[model samples]
Target chain A: MSCWDTIADYGLRSLGIGERLLPRDNFTLCQQVTLIGSGMIWNVYFGTLAMVSGFFLATAVALGKAAQSPLLRKPSEWFIFVFRGSPLFIQFFFAYFLFLSLKQTHPIFEPFTAAWLGALIVLFLNTAAYSGEIFYGALQSIPKGDLEAADAYGFTGWNKFRRITWPTMLRLAWPAYTNEAIFLFHATALVFFSGFPAWQQRGDALYYASYFADKTFNPFIPYPILAGYFILLTLTVTGLFGLVNRRLNRHLPQQSRSKLRLRPNLLR
Target chain B: MLCYLTTGKHMAIYVSVLVVLVLLAITAVTALIFGFGGAMAARSRFLPLSWFGKGYIAIVRGVPDIAFFLFFVLALDIGFEMLRHGIKCPDWTAPIWQGNDFVVCPEAKLPLGNAPQWVHETYAFFLAVLTFSIVFGAFAANVLYGAMRAVPRAQLETAEAYGMTHRQTFWRVLVPQMWVYALPGLSNLWMVLIKATPLLFLLGIEDIVYWARELGGSKTPRFTDYPHGDWRMWYFLALLVFYLAFTRVSEIALDRIMRRLTHGQATLAGEAQRKAAT
Candidate 1:
């Protein structure tokens, strides 16, 4: 079949549209590309949703970690440690199995077994822990002068945090936070490979790429195409984060401001 | 039943941890070698070699490591088979990549095609190690390069004034001093390497993740004498605890080592140590 025909049939295959069965024989480049591209929609969906939601949760976690009371600080510390210390792959497996066991015990929890909820829960907690650590470090590193200035102006408690502490914490954490965001996006690839089953053979880009590789016994094509798509995806993530970083630092003098540098050292 | 947990399949789970450790050791050595070479190349006067080393670090940075992990395993397998086909069966006429089949003469097959099951497992483990080394090496190279630069120029100049050659200074002064700066980054990388061990399952190595799924999944009487419902959650929870404990221990050990290394040095950590002691 021609490339156009392949696209027409498999364009939305990942969503359970247009095709019932994947092309088992005569796997064309177009079919591989189209299906893998279709699969990318899932990756972007998981990454974007998890990163966005995780951002707010992580701020709360960081604040909790920075709290004066040991009651708040201790739990937040352990939460961050548990998630940060373990593998994301294991987290997925554990979450899936936990969800499965929960489903068995309570049929009402069945929805939690599916990838939509299962993977999201894992990614959300994972990102929150990582970003929480970054934000916690930033909170500790916030200039003491800023807090003193707020206190002198009679700002205290919520007002002090809102006007001075929170903004500065975010600003200080922005660069490292950007790195955490990109890693979270890349990590979404692992969701499918983990214990969570991709319903209806619907999976992310790596899944479809592996499928094509298995079918064609050719890795040279499909894997590279998937990598290409991921490269573009990473570029887009970097661009979006860079824009936010710029806005966060907009008030700072150019010489004093830090740029969103792509330091790969933040992996994991 | 719990009886199955004491059987050979359970043994597989324990053995998988060994596989992970073995991969860790192999990847560490190979990545260090790769990192050393890349670090040296980046410092080279030659523009092309420096650019190539720099590019290797840059490209792997943004892309998801899982992408490279998947890509390299298959690509390396194909490349190896093609090499074996060229050498082992010179008289064979069949094309290597025909339609969807990568058929080589039976003699050209990796692990010799008819080798024992253990040999095939060993081969897969070897490939996983190589892939990990290549990916992590770039990160290591980046850290090493920065550490090398961070070593004060005055020390190097003093070495030069003493009539030591650049190579001698690099080995005796620069390399020794660079570790203090590199320790934090390298320690973080070690944690990443530990977390990455689970990806071995994707490469077909029967690591902890694989066995957890296998042993945890629902078992029927047909499959085994002790049938049980899915217990993967518990197994993975056990794995989670193992990792957390391991990382915590590593963190403590690394902190101690860093403290020792920074003792009597000019860095902030050293100053803190001095104040605490007094």
Candidate 2:
């Protein structure tokens, strides 16, 4: 088959579309690329959903962590501690088993046993913890003058937080938040690798790359292709986050704008 | 019921904690060595060497490290065998890349197909250490590179004016001073390393995660004296507590060290120390 035919056959294979059985023989460069690219659909899905949902959770968590009341503070602190303290791999195992056992009790939780929901929940909690810490630090380090000015303007509680505190916290936390985001994106690859089973051979990019590597005994190709896709991913994340970063800092002078530096925190 | 906790396989879980600790200690040392080398390479006067260093640091930036953990174990294993095949089975004309298989001569198999089980275990462990070092080394290099730069230029210049050569200056002044700056990053890396120990399972080592699953999985009453429902949640809860406790202890220890490192230095941490002394 021509490369186009190959692409058409395996392009949506990760979503379990177009092709059923994977290319079992004569694995072409095109097939590996397409299959792996298709697999990226899962990675992107997991990363984006986890990140988007996690961001809101992270903001609440950060505020809770910074709250004055022990009722709010204690649970928030422990949540961050428990999640942050353990490896994402262990969390995946624990959650999968938790869901598996829970499924025995109720039919509603059956979906939670699958990678899409289960692993997404794990990644979501994991990123929320890490980002919550970052946001908490940012919240703590928000300039005293800013809060004072808000108070002077008769701003209080939700009004003060919305107009002043939240924006400033985001602006301060943006760089570190950018790092959390990229790492969270990378951490999505672990979803399939962990205890969560990739249903119907539908795995993420690393899953497909390993699939090809195992099939061909040629790691040189598939891994680099996956890395290429990942680098593209990293670049995309930086570029998009940079836009928000720009908007966050648009009120400030040009010289003082914090550039998004990709200092990677490798694993949670 | 308590006896179930001491079953042979359950004993492996206890041993695997030690395994995780050993991997932690060894990987930390090797990763430091790799980091030092990578940092040196990255800051070299030669353009190519510096580029190589920068590239090494940039690698983990883009790729998910689990991908590296998965890729390197297989790649390194096959790579070693292929090298041995070239050396040991020189007369064999068959290609290593047979369709859907890596057909190295049996003679070329690492630890040989017939080697003692310990040899195979040691070999696999060695590959895992190398992979961890390579990936974490890049992270450490990134840390060390910034640390080195953070060492004020004035300090290096003083060493140079004292007739210290570049190597002497680097060894005596630059490396010594960079540690203060590097400590925070290194400590964080240490926590990351601890969290990463469970990934040894992915490298095919029967580490703690392996034992957790084996011991926690529901077992039939026919197989053992103890029978229980799936207790993985409890096993994992125990594991989670182990990690959280470890993290807390490390944080305390690291805080003490950070205080010591910052005691008299001129950095912000040091400035805070000076203020507190007053």
Candidate 3:
């Protein structure tokens, strides 16, 4: 078939749309590209959803970790440690199995077995922990002067936190949090690799890329395609985060605003 | 069921833990070598070498490392086999790349067709180790390169005034001082390295993840006496706890080492130490 035919058929193939069966033999470059591009939809889906939800959860976790009460602090500390210390790959495996076992007992967990929900949950927790750590560090590092200013203005407790603490913590954490988000985005590739099956070959970008590599016995093409897609995805994430970062620093004068440069460090 | 635990295959699961540790140790050493070389090359006067080092560091920035892991293993395997094919099977002219298949002569096959199973496993393990080293080496190179630059320029100039050669100054003055600057970044890389070990399962090794899945799968009564429902959750939970404890211990140890390393250095920590000593 022509390239257009391949795109038409495999454009939404990863979502189980046009194509019922993947190209088994005589794989074309277009087929490889289209299928892998289709698969990236899942990566974008997982990364965006997890990050959007995880931001709020991570903030809550950071607050809990910094809370005065042991009741809140202890669990938050342990949650951060458990998620941060372990391999995310193992987390996915464990979560998938846990969901599977739960499915055996409860019908509500049936949807959780699917990669969209189950793997997303694992990614959610994993990013929350890493981002929570960043925010917690930022929380602790928030200048004492800022809190004192808030207290002098009669901004007590929740108001103090809302006005002074949360914004500053986020500003301090944004750079590192950007790194964590990118890391988590790259990590969505691990979902299919875990025990979580890519139902009906509807996997992520790496999945389609690996599939093509296996079928064609050529690693050069599909892997780079996947890498290129990921590169673009990471760039987009950095850009989006940079925008939020600017908003976070809007109150500061231009001379004082810390420039947001993407650092090459792994997740903090 | 008890006999299964005693068998070699089952025992291999526990052995795989050691395999991971061995992989970690070997990868750590090799990655340091690659990183050092990369840093040196990046700093070299030669343009090509500098470009190569820069490329090595930049390559990790955009791509998901799992892609590299998957790609390098197969590419390296084929590369080795292709070289052996050209050298060993000169007379055979059937194209190695015939459409979709990579059919190398039997003599060209790694470990030879009739070699023992352990050799094959060892070779695979070696490849996995190499791949891990290469990927992580780039990250380390990035860290070390920055650290090298972070060393005080005055110290290097002082070494030059003392009539030390460039190489001697680099070794004695620059390298020693760079560690203090590099420690935080390197420690972060080490944690990342520890977290990355589970990807070995993706490389198709019988690591802990492999064992967890194999043991946790539902075993029918017909298959074995130890029939059990799917218990992968529990097995993976054990693996999770093991990793958490390992990382926690590593964190504590690394923190202690940082204090020791920074005892009299010029960093903030060292300044704090000096004040406390006074």
Candidate 4:
């Protein structure tokens, strides 16, 4: 097939579009690049949805964790610990099974079995736990002077939190939050490899890369293409987060503000 | 069968846990060695060495580790076979990469083609360890670099004033103090390493996830012995519990160690300790 013909047939293969069958023999460089690049749509989908939803949930979780009462604090603490402690791969497996069992008993929940719900649920909880820890640390580290200033100005409870505590916590946590965001994006690649089967053979980038590797018995070409896509994704995420970090730290004097540092130590 | 759970699958699960522990230990040591070398190179007067170390850290950090895992496994496998081919069969002249097949002379296989199954398993396990080390080594290098920088400047100056050699001062003052600074980042990295153990399944090692799927899939009487509905979910739930407990225990232990490391240090934790004592 010509390069244009190959593109037309396989460009949307990952979405169960034009191509009925993947290239079997004579896998060309264009085929590998286009197919893997097409598969990247799933990666971006999982990462973006998970990060966006996980952000709000994580904020709530962090607030719960910082609560004064045991009723609120205890549950949040346990939630954070359970999700943070377990591997995301295992979480995917466990969640898949749980969803499967639930569907068996109640068919109405069958929608949860697909990646849209199953993988998203796991990624959501996992990122929340990780970001919760970061936010919790930031909450604790908020300057006593800031709280005192709020109190002196008669900023009470909800108002105090809204006007003072929340902004400060976000500012303090922003750098670490950026690290958590990048890792969450990377962790999304594990979704297909875990319990959630790639429905209709429509898999993610790594999945397609593995498919090509298995067929051609050559890992040299396909895997690097996948890696290149991910590196680009990682750079884009870093750039976007840097912009947010800049906005968060805008009020501070340049010398007093902290720069966002990429730390790869954050994991599921 | 219940008997398989008690004997076969049970043993496999436990063995997989040991596999994870072994991988953890090997990766930690290997990465530390790599990190130390990288750190020294980064601080070297030679610009090329410093650039190489910095570039290594940056490249690994930018890419997802799963990508590296996939790439290295194949690269290393090919590289190994080619080395063996060069040594064991110098006269042989068949192309190793013919279209799709990577056919080396039968004599050139690392775990010889005729070797027992366990040899093949061990080879896969070794590859998994190497992948983990290479990826985690970069993170370790970053942490160690920061820790090395964090060591107080005055101590090094005093050693220089006392006419101590650079190596002597580095060993006596810098190395000792660097640990206190390095401990926090290392502890965080340790947690990450623990969580990453599940990737072993992807590497084709029969870790817990493998057994979970194998033993949990629906079984019919014709398959072997026990027949049951799909119970893979329950098996995975058990795996989750196992990991959660493992990580919780590690967290508690690490917090205690951090406390010990921070005692009498100038950090905020030390101030808190002093206040509590008073």
Scored by lDDT, the top model is: 2
lDDT of 4 at B233: 84
**Best-performing candidate as measured by DockQ:** 2
lDDT of 3 by residue, B1-278 (tens): 57756655568788989998999899999998999899989988899999999999988887888899999999999999999999998999888898988899999999788999889989889899999999989988998999999988888999999999989998989888888788888888888898899898888888888888888898899977767888889889999999998888989998999999889998888999999999
How far in Å is the alpha carbon of B178 misplaced in model 2? Answer: 1.1
Query: lDDT at A119 for candidate 2?
Result: 90
Overall lDDT per candidate, in order of appearance: 0.87, 0.90, 0.89, 0.86
The CA lDDT at A228 in model 3 is 88
User: How much native contact recovery, as a fraction, does model 4 achieve?
Assistant: 0.71
Error of 1 at B260 (Å): 2.0
Candidate 1 docking class: medium
Q: Tell me the tens digit of each residue's lDDT in model 1 across A91-132.
A: 998898888889887999898888988899899999999999
Candidate 4: deviation at residue B182, Å?
1.0
**Model 4 C-alpha lDDT per residue in residues B1-278, reported as the tens digit of each score:** 55757755568878887888888889999988888888878877799999998987877765567777777888888889999999999998878888878889999987898999999999999998888888888888888988999988998999999999999998898888788889888888888888888888888899878988887888898965667889998888888898888888888999998888888887788899989999
Deviation from native of the Cα of residue A205 in model 3, angstroms: 0.6
TM-score of each: 0.95, 0.97, 0.96, 0.93
Interface RMSD of 1: 1.6
Interface RMSD of 3: 1.7
Q: What are the per-residue Cα lDDT tens digits for candidate 3 across A228-257?
A: 898999989899989999999999988988
- The most accurate candidate by TM-score is 2
Tens-digit lDDT string for candidate 2 (A1-268): 8999988888888888888898888988999999999999998999999999999999999999999999999999999999999888889989999999999999899999999899999999999999999999999999999999899999998999999999999999999999898898888888887788988898889899999888887899999999999999988989999999999999998899888876765786
